[model samples]
Target: MSSTNRRDFLRASAAAALSAAVPADLFAQSETAQSSPGAIWDSGSVRHLLPTVSDSRMLIKVSFTAPVEGEPRLHVGDLTVRGSMGDTRGEHWHFYATDLGPGRRYPLSLVGSNGRALCQPWELATFPGPDERPNRFRLLIYTCGGGHEVHKFLPTAVRNRLLRRGLSFQPDAMIANGDHVYWDLLAPVGSRLLGAAPEAVKAAGTFDRSAIVLGSDNETVLKRAAGPQIVPVYGTDFRSTPVFFLQDDHDYFDNDEATDEVVTFPPSYFMLQLARATQGIYYPEFLPDSARPLGLPWSSGRDRAWGVSESFGTLRFGRLAEILLYDVRRTQTMAGPSAVYIDPAVEKWLKARTAATEVAHVVHVPSNPPGWTAGKWGEWYPDVLGREGKLTTNEPKPYWQPGWLKQHDRLIEAMAAVKGRAPLVISGDLHAIAIGRMLRSGRLDLKDNPVNVVLSGPLGSRPGPLGWPSGRRGTGAMPSAHLDMEEQVKPIEQHGFTVADFTREKIVLRLFKWDIKTQPVEAIDTLQPFHTAELTRPA
Candidate 1:
């Protein structure tokens, strides 16, 4: 079947499942509540939430203030607050009042346990109506961050400053390509090595001092660790503003494995659960059931794992472009002939979507093949490199290995076949920023194959001084022994997120590196003007 058909089938299936999950009465209640002016809410302990999208019918996922110990009750009628989605479960509520309507300010009054009403500082204004014209959207991209140490936030601050300047130039959306959170590293020390040990040795090691300390106090360590707090803060700052999130190796499990295989690392699951719980992701609703198989097929061994596969489908914003959200992590291969490969179904879907679109822009969310050669930063097991010297055996794996230019060539072919359109590939993963144009071989019949590939990463993590593995460096800001791109493209060393502004006539990709010293540290480097690109329609 074609990709579009498959996607339609999947959506239909999910909608059916969702309909089944919510009974008639609950659905009617939600519908009624939505029609009425929602109650206003105050922001207190509610930190952050996830899957930020603007579809009115979309099932919103959120997280709010956890209840105090032994006092799990909150009386909503007492406090004065603003900008709330609404109350669902008793005492527990999710707010989505941002940008609701003109002149109508919605705020909620909350009654605390003390019988006093406190007002929340923030209010949710209704969102602006969709733009009728082709609207320009910017995406802030980053990936492969190891942890959220204070230093990590430094780069993000710098990038934010740059974005502030960039935003002045153009409006845009933020896309966190993957590795949004580095939860795997927060696992207690020595936990990653658990499976490598023999059963007897593992049992004995489990009782060791370090293991006992970590296992006993894993939650405490994770809460205090660099990632938990940092991710929420970073997410809160950006997610509320504008963004789309994709999961990478770090978000799912360290080095990219199914959830079941990495069960020994309790903190990984804990952090993910916390992220979901706090964000109001409605895990049971959005995620697929482990007991059943649907959407993308998985190995029998990989079934029954705690993971969710979601296809954002396609977004056509007026006449500007079509944005396709592809989940590459779910279909990854750990022990197969290759390390990374797009599922055949997904590949077909992508091809059909691109082929069907004549819109001025197309955005894909996956790390470009060329960026993988930067070497693993103490993340995944090193033994997985196949005999082909490539990470994966997928058709695109061989020519696309490391520093080879053929990866770009194959990518160009794929784009050219997409109804002969020139596509701008937006990606993250390598903890660095890159921008380049890929020109297809004349043999491919693509006159405009030289489309740009824009990448930004390390939003919270710091950029390393040099490329990895010394001799096999691919492409990065650092001068390396492996690949040299001085003639073709030069990488700049600014550690922050990236924002891409797309219009009908052109696509401008701007890199925003944050400046940490400023009080509201999310300032941009004034020196770097917007990096603009004017793309002509393909003939």
Candidate 2:
């Protein structure tokens, strides 16, 4: 054979041998992997791994130890779906896959540029389709889950152990009602009192508008501020469970306080920017629901296109129940009589959902609670802490808006009007585990159809001394003067969560709690719920 023909034949033979040695799928994956430096993977490199799944879709948020060099890929079943960088910084990436089968558990894994698995494979199941009715559904609910770096009020070990105990129940899903990040820039405990390391403590001083968040020098400070609060506490514990994270006042880096100098809520432009950046990196946004209509206020282009929402969300578990989740802090306004904690459009959507009969049960999960108040400025009632340290409406709260109370009345009335199923509201923000039935609000009387409210306790906060670090409200959560409530389980200050079991007949709520000083460390492993409240369908 000629020299040229011999070289061609050798090249073809080498190519054929290489293809035979590699698996067909891996070879195909390598072809699509980005032609750039990529993220290095070890079992510990992924600092945070969380996924949120809908009936036919799943969105996974993966945060690496360092900025990723190229796009990551998710391998599920027979598909190799490409992922996009999810944050301004390169550390966080997202993998969104659609066309998944409803109610089916699919094993998923991440692959690098070399076509090798980055970590062990895990299984995630999609929710049952809207029309399909599963026998039972269970949800794990909690709030104020963020902890400071300096204080051991809620040590990392205790927080993880408590969550592990709750996970032992094998809940179908989890809802972190609000206040997921507690780095309150204005609070003394968050500012000067935290026990963080010297250098680390220095970085938490003040917000720097000079540097862009997640993509600039602020990235280091942001990580130092939020990383320990979230990463170590959750780790990979929630890798398999779908988590619905709702943001509140603290998530925006401020407390819901109104002082002569400033009103911390109605988040400022910078606070909003930081909140968005934090969420984009640490967790997944709410999956889109077709029932939630279009043209909702502040609907970003990406949010509208993907049908995902940043503030409003829905947890539709077959036809057994439909839970509407809304963040009260994000879009709150201060237009006096025109003021609203939620947009008028969102309020309309909420009322419509409350009145719907297709679902056996309808529940409202708001970032703010209604039945009780801690005498805070941002509340449904204009109650303030009396000189004696108790919530009293004798003196109107300073800077409190009247519209908030009006909107609260409208929502309660809507829930009361529902037929067949009992009206229920499960809320977070108040650091207590309590259940009450609101028979009246302002002039509106929900006498015949009382609104059931549940404060699904705090997971990471402690009721300790130095109330600021402990996150214990000054007056605790108490029934406001205008509210006529039947307090089933009065507000109890402790670190805990609620487990709710939903069926067509009724809903059962179990409250589990533990005190850092009282409960032995080992006792956490076998901790059982302390209170149980059952609400049945209307006769």
Candidate 3:
């Protein structure tokens, strides 16, 4: 059968199933009806759920504690769609509905084969159509949400409290920039903080490195290591909100380090598989974009079918704003002169999006932060730690590739070239809250139209012994070499997140901070933005 015919047949079958599964009285209600507040919620079978939405698609991942007895379907008012089982162990289920109405709210529930509700009925709204413009769009943005095993620096309870506070503002969506999990199997400092016995760590390293994560012994080990970091903190609190999760160095089960004995970047095949498995089980893949080709890096033929890119994604809010999301760690290469922190294809796509005027505002959300470097081997700049733990370019940074800097300059130039819009970049990896502009990069000068960057605050970092790895690198984020720039909000090591509001006239950012040492735990409930900056659209 042709593709058109296949789609028609499936649609008819779904309608028939919906007629049979849904009650006659319930089917009378409109698909866009409001969610029932007093609906029965089943927290036993469905432990948790997270959803991702686009202009016309909604993808939800549900976790079950026990095996599902029969086929489960997602009931969205009068419409019912079948759920696809995920993972070999049968705990994860994915319900994907496409060709949904744009900018419409859908109240949905999951019903089992026996016609019992599996989860609470929740509401999710799709994005506006491509040509349409929204008056306002709000996002809850944060980074470094993961924590060390034994470290209580921003424990799960505290993280949830912060997230609930952010939710109170009722953000349209959430962007978890990077470092969602922190169980580094390698790297010296991280390994010691694994909070596991030395023997157990050794066993995990050997077994996980040799096994495929999907069906083999590695899946359980991967779950044991990653589940605690993600499931507990996020839980079902985000059931009504769409989340975009970007992976960084720690998400690959190690830090980006290059020492004499081992180089931890350009993730090994096992590391890549483990990362894939973790995302496959926990989160939703990025929805498809017509502008982004499937041949891009970290994409497979199977991924092409789903139209999802694991490393590159787009969060478009109507014609008002388009935020490009890219993972700078997974596809990075270290081939000397050609080494790149992001795939060249991704760079090309980013440049094209940056230059496009389809959206009133264009923002870049990379897992790797620009503007400041911590004198690390994986950073774009070649700066190294000087005396008194200051960053300086005089000392050569070992294992630092020059190609990374070249690519960074090209991207900066592309963002600056855009007319009538601020070249805004929000990222999180540096573990600090900072706002700056790249006035000059190497020989390229962005002084006329500087590229603005914001280091979205870390959500789970602390100071002293329980702080982020950067706490050991230096005092905080510092200006790297070869760049002339001005720091508006100088880097401050604090635990917080950024709330950004995108509008046609301007983009407003409210940066919130909470110091675990200086502030009381209850202060998190009423934390306010310490600073607010507005970038008005160019005339």
Best lDDT goes to which candidate? Answer: 3
- Residue-level lDDT of model 3, residues 316-356, one tens digit each, is 88899898999989888888888898887889889988889
Candidate lDDT values, in order: 0.39, 0.76, 0.77
Q: Candidate 2: misplaced stretches above 4 Å? A: 1-44, 187-200, 203-206, 298-305, 467-473
lDDT of 1: 0.39
Residue pairs clashing in model 3 are none
Judged by whole-model lDDT over C-alpha atoms, candidate 2 comes out at 0.76
User: What's the TM-score of every candidate structure?
Assistant: 0.58, 0.88, 0.89
Quote the lDDT for 196 in model 1: 19
Residue-wise C-alpha lDDT for candidate 1, range 118-192, written one tens digit per residue: 223222211222333444544445654334443233344344344344333323344556654443432332224
Q: How many collisions between residues are there in candidate 2?
A: 1
What ranges in model 1 sit over 4 Å off? 1-43, 49-51, 58-135, 144-146, 150-172, 183-232, 235-240, 256-316, 334-340, 368-372, 375-412, 440-448, 463-488, 513-527
Q: Candidate 2 or 3, higher lDDT? A: 3
Instruction: List the candidates ranked by TM-score, beginning with the highest.
Output: 3, 2, 1
- Greater-lDDT candidate between 1 and 3: 3
Among all windows of 10 consecutive residues in model 1, the one with the lowest summed lDDT is 13-22
